[model samples]
Target: MTCKKNMVIIRSFKQRPVCSECQMRSLSGPVSDKKFKKLFDIDPKFYETSAFLRDIRYQYSLYQNLTEKQIAAFKRVVDEFKNPKKKQINAIVPKAPTKEEQAEHKQKRAKGLFQSERSTLRALRTK
Candidate 1:
């Protein structure tokens, strides 16, 4: 649905009742609210994955003029996905190395193919 400030072009399908989703529409982008329902009903966890993340990210960008309430609702859905209680598998990815480990890593990086990989200007002439 296209909108400009106060005016909006609301959609009407032949079968379903009138949409109460104008507010929802503004944030969720051009994908009809019906699609959201169908996807959620099929699997509530679908939104937690990359497909839904990509959809919402695109929607957020496409519909930049959403109200604060709609934005909150959008964030709530994302937060629900990120809730720790729902975590089952190895969601806790590996941790970053300590500073000493990082220093060691940098030292390793400075020693190996790093020198040979340098630009021609940075490389020394043959002895």
Candidate 2:
């Protein structure tokens, strides 16, 4: 009688947990303590990444400086992450103003002041 070889089949059904990059993207927007806790509860390993931890620390540093709207936007993004259907590979996060916006804003302000001054001088001359 010939011996029969055994056949083994392996089935892969489980998905790997979210990676650090994904978790960090999930936290990109501003978050409150409650939202922070919720995220930590979902994945404690999120803070394992150095960059993610640094960002969290940086955001905290400005805890008192952020406007209500900014904080709310952050909360909304975090909430999206909490829900599985809304989870995405790359979330759209709001960014702060760039040097260009600052420069343009300054130029606009200067132009407005100059126009106001010119109008005042014209009025004085007419009177």
- Winning model by TM-score: 2
The residue pairs found clashing in candidate 1 are: none
**Residues 1-127, candidate 1, lDDT per residue (tens digit)?**
4224454333555322322233334335444455344433323344434343444444555663445665566666666666745555555776779999999879978786565566554655532
Which digits, one per residue and each the tens of the lDDT, describe model 2 over residues 27-78? 4555556745453343434354343343443465456244566556545555
Candidate 1, superposed: residue stretches over 4 Å from native: 1-53, 84-127
The number of the candidate with the highest lDDT is 2
* Global lDDT of each candidate: 0.49, 0.53
Pairing residues by index, what is the TM-score of model 2?
A: 0.25
> How many clashes show up in model 2?
0
